[model samples]
Target: MTALTTPREASDRGGPVADIGPLPARRGRRQHRLAPLIFISAAVVLFILFFLWPGALGLLYSFTDYRGVGDLNFIGTENYRELVGDDDFYRALGRTFLYTALAVPAHYVVSLAVAVLLTSKTAKGKSIARVVFFLPWLLSPIVTGVVWRWLFGENFGFVNHVITQLGGSSVAWQTDGTLGLLVVVIAGTWASTAFNMLLFIAAIRNIPRSYLEAAEIDGASPAQRFFKIQLPLLAPTSFLVILLTTIGAMKEFAMIQALNGGGPGTENMLMVQYIYRTGFERADIGYASAVSMVLMLILVVVALIQMRFDRKSALS
Candidate 1:
């Protein structure tokens, strides 16, 4: 057996006293503290590099007449002043808002409906149904656009072929601005519904079964149980879903680009598309940056307003 000595005895021997309890505990505590920081450092570095750095550069460029190549001349808000008076900018912004307004509610309703269906106790083949529902979301936006374009292509396309076979004329899905916008809205909703459905499913599952059982025992119909208990309880998740959907809709680009290229003469051009055209096509980087900054501000304002409304709803 190894020799054991008291602290006093060890110190008297001119040897360091054993720290049986505190040393290991302190080291463990330090490891615990450091692990979180080490884990988060990579994310922090990425956020700084990708988001903050680019955002700073964009903001700086917004105040300067920096064409993609030439010397930067500080225009001191001239880009912003011109943006304020630009008809195209306003139209794009309005279209973006319209898209968001249409998309968010559709996403909510369809996703919620799917979630409710999948979570029903009597539902069968849920796994297969979930996979099928989620497949659209797994597709690349470009692929989704291509698939939708094929389906709704104006002529020599599947839908038109079916229509012509059935004695109806081919619809102007690609060429008509309103019809094209409607197609995009439908495609966006289909692509996005799965993720929001998952969120609602998780939220619904977390709710106590007892409450639902009690509501059922009290002779509540399916709709009554949902509206009286489930819907009220879902407010937080609903808010989150709506907020995320709104932000995503506002920033949408790839799907729209692939689907219609903001076509029919910029009739459906969104704010991001407008920015892209200004910066890349027109070589007006300064104006594009200004528009980006304004769009960012608008998103911030919208988010804040939504948060305020959510808070008030919760409090009341």
Candidate 2:
């Protein structure tokens, strides 16, 4: 019962026919165009305010004599010059490197092993096990540090109590510099390993089971299957884990604060801890900024190197 109208008549009548085609779609798109911007506006603002602005300001202040106070003077790399010659800074730098070197490998090895075990076909109650393992990661760093500190305390602590009960002499864990650093490393490893394990588990689970089955059918041993099949495929995830753990170890400060307070004469001082002390305690904002810039540079270079390796691995 409907009559066909010409396009010119439809246009003149302003009917629904005139409004059909791309016009509404274009209008709808234009209306929705602001929706995404609206949703992301908050994140964009926060990124600029918290990350970009602060980082830019810190970099700018590194070259100036801004002691977190009124007067500021551009010292022209004087802070960096002092940073280069500062023996304490170098000592902390070395300690940070040592921590990263030891902690990253230990964490990775343990996490990978745990991930493999958890993902195996014979594994039972993996959900419960995963939760139990990841519980430490749910706790705050300060809480973990404090609990471990107490456990490793000199007298009447759980570890020492057990040791003494076993006829071993009670050890002064937090007093000695080397022992204190060791405790920090161990605590850091325990706290962080679970998260890394989860990553590894995901990566392992993503690998096709058919590959392993074929290898096993060919009379390959478990070790051979792991090395030739799983390990090679896990290179990308391994690279990610290493880079993250290394950066984390380098920036460790809170755990040290809660555990030993960088005691035994700065023997366990991390780069971030040193930066915090310099800026907040020593009130040397400029020098602290310069140190932060150095740390940033180190992290950037490490990330770039990892990226290069990852790209090469992928290509191969």
Candidate 3:
């Protein structure tokens, strides 16, 4: 027990002390890293199981002829090739694109313009206006769709009734191919725009009144102050909301399907509706999976582009 080793012996021996004591080597610190590691590991595992695993399997299935009946077989790009010539695919894609394009900017502009109006002046109608505006978004989409479907129906629609009351013929509000699509877009926009408007109102309210006061003191008009100051700060949120709305509009099957049943030669058929028809009605799950994968790719590209624009707008 009294034996003392020289420094040379200790160095030469390279024994347990260096690995276990004194510095306690690299391995011991690894145990200290376990808590964070455990958290990260669990997250990764859940991510793989819930989202990534399913997505990967779906992507693989996209290339095969599974048909939801038998074992999946690898066909090697045949589904994609067929998808290239698929007319319904293109038509649905076009409708979805148009819906997102027209509906998004229209809602943002109309709603923001209304919010701007409401935010100004000491008016008695403000609270009631806010509630009325927000009430549509509060209802379930199915309920909203059902009510609006009757309100836009070709035979008994309220809008056509109004036109008739004004001495006009009952218009084909949801019968003509293009007009039916427009009705869906308008109704969809009406149901959702109020939600966006409330957000703008909240954002506008949170901004300091001192800035507006300062602007007003300098003879800056309401428009000038809003454009020069408040809007710039709200740009990030607005961009994000638009992104969400655009994506939602792209996948809007329920409203379109419920309203017109993708009527008039399936002109109102959205991408999701097409996929649904292919899968269930046509009972071609393989082809449907292929179509879905294509839709996913399109959405991903669109989202990336919007994010890039938002980022650039923020930086600028």
Candidate 4:
């Protein structure tokens, strides 16, 4: 027996068939993938417009006689040529490096020691000590410099008063070239120690207790355990702290301004202060821009070197 569909029924089933191929579906899929990018595109545009565009313009203006206003003229490396012979700028540059070299190590060592003490079982009032130590870090660098300036005051300061009470002559801490720079370093070290201490503290606590217990069971002395175990583990954290502290030290300006205003005839002048005084006070905008570009290059080179060193150290 055979059952057959009629022609009307076959036409009814096939009447609405139409082909829409993979191209249209692929177009729909592409839009689905691009939807998230729409939300993030505004931030990307803003960064390029504000940061990248301004930076590029600054680099261009460095080579021209753009006096922060008025007509601009193409000077063709004249600003850079003048910078090569600027003795004051060179001196400020040297002082900045010297301060960084001194302050970074001093801060690192002292902060590590304090962090060890605070995290030790024998230490008392750990929370209170941490709070007191970190309070100075919370203060603005300008405020720290101002307060230290008062403390370094010749006669009326508490430090001078104490010296007088002890029958010692009052000392001028900021007039001598060497002493002035040393005071600046001391103030910077004090201001930054707490933050580094906190970093070291957290790093030390993260070390596995099992390693220490194992070392002790093997009859290792505390010093032996620390040097052989803890120091090796902390190398990464040490690298990070050094890198950050070095950069911060290099850009020091607020403290220098509030402390001595780059006084004593540029004894305490730093790179940033030099740039500021040149661009604003002297109205040498072109030269200032050139100097700033040089600084940016120096920082970039140093940072690259540091990163390479850190990577090798960590691998070893």
Candidate 5:
């Protein structure tokens, strides 16, 4: 009887309630406190290294005459003031806007459709097909540029050779402003759309099969189900892809380098390429920094506008 009473006392006093009641809660509290601090610390470090420090340096340099090396002098808003009258700045801006308008939609439309097709079982050899589609993207920009340059070569090139064979005169592809820009645009689209295809493919695969099956059962066709149900659900993902691709297009330099090297007469010169020409080629660091800041402002404004539209669409 005494032994039984001893065991009951131990059970009541030394059970989980006594050992774990406040201990787990205390550990959880500690973890909660540490987690945010850890996250914030990491963010602070990364922001300082990646964005804040470089931005601060550029902002300061924009107001000075720091052309790589030697003496530097603060010149107020002279850099900005000079840009107002710079014809190159205006030209770059115009070309950039045009490029964005054309390339962004072409990329989204073609890639999304390809993604849909790739996701379909009716499609044959999906992995082999993906690899084929992705082949352009896998090559280095320099390599693509060299190949295209040879194809667009003035004489004895594949492109012109074909033209002559077809009983047409051989044209100087790179020297023709219209042809050069067109080639750049097409190559840029072809090179870029594959990555976007992969994104859409991933997003499409994650969609619940039950939802699609139910839509089919209700006599909805593939087009109607895709547009009304799938697209609506995939809205956020599409928005994200568009935003990123647009931003990327705005900053395009490599593809242009590969395709036209900023073209026949600076006609295809995008803003970043213009900025590169200004800083390194022309040796005007201060003015180039000013141009960069302007580009940054444009991107930020666009991003804000996109965010507002996204939120509005999501609510609607």
Candidate 6:
């Protein structure tokens, strides 16, 4: 009896071979094509379920008079019209912008400074310093707010106690709107700095050492080297940090809420807190949804502007 050869072996030997099925390599290629889709299917599902669907519903509700319950009577753009003329809405939006303006710059400066320090060649105890610097980013926003509140509390607080001990009057941190907002800005910056610092650190470390060495050999001072080489190179990372910080500051709610409950007569109420109060506290879901849509539009516009600026900067 003749020994049977496998199809591959027969083909190799120049004999006619019967086709069995798709080869393992072809099957593997198919699996490879499918692997990414398989891995990302869960994330896509979650995005649709949690984000897209809700956003669609919110958009739909914004055109109606849905008061969290009852009949959804269609009101067209009345909610938006009302939002346009509402002084409280404008104040909240303005306050939100103010917070973003204050917080983003502070966040950028502090984070970049820390990142530069940590990434410096002559820095000491880098490992310990990195951990200490990064710890605040691990904290929940509410927790951070609560901690700051305790430190800045109006009466019987640590800060006040220290001031009084040093023969100074107790400051109205919570009651006074400006002081309250200042505390929130400080807390927000402190809470958010670590993450941005990590981004800056990565960007800085990725900068080629040869550039700095070349600059130094050309008689450039540390500040000159940084301004001419390091700072220019860090543009992309800086833009990213600014964009993210702006968005985070715009959407700030929980921290401010936990800190002063948007208190001092809604003086410190940011847009998100305003939305929450309008939707939940007052049960004006449709109008609140409209406000949220406006906020979303503002964020989209800001992101687009930043991206455009970044592209221009990159080109120039």
Question: Considering every candidate listed, which one attains the maximal lDDT?
Answer: 1
- Name the 10 consecutive residues with the lowest summed lDDT in model 3: 15-24
- Candidates' TM-scores? 0.93, 0.90, 0.81, 0.85, 0.84, 0.93
TM-score of candidate 6 relative to the true fold? 0.93
Candidate 4 lDDT by residue in tens digits, 52-161: 88778778889998878888798999998988999998999999899899998998998998998998888999999999899999999899989988888675667888
Candidate 6, residue 129: CA error in Å?
1.3
Q: Rank the candidates by TM-score, best first.
A: 1, 6, 2, 4, 5, 3
How big is the positional error of residue 174 in model 5, measured in Å on the Cα after superposition?
Answer: 1.3
> Regarding lDDT, does 2 or 3 come out ahead?
2
What TM-score should be assigned to candidate 2?
A: 0.90
Positional deviation of residue 201's Cα in model 2 after best superposition, in angstroms: 1.4
Q: Give residue 138's error in model 3 in angstroms.
A: 2.3
lDDT of 1 by residue, 54-116 (tens): 999999999999989979999898998898799999999999999999999999999999999
Clash totals in order: 0, 0, 0, 0, 0, 0
Q: Report residue 213 deviation for candidate 1 (angstroms).
A: 1.5
**What stretches of model 2 exceed 4 Å from their correct place?**
1-22
lDDT of 6 by residue, 130-224 (tens): 99989999999899989988999988679999999999999999889999999999999889989999999999999999999999999999999
Each prediction's whole-model lDDT (CA) = 0.94, 0.90, 0.83, 0.87, 0.86, 0.93
Flag regions of model 5 displaced more than 4 Å: 1-44
lDDT of 3 at 145: 76
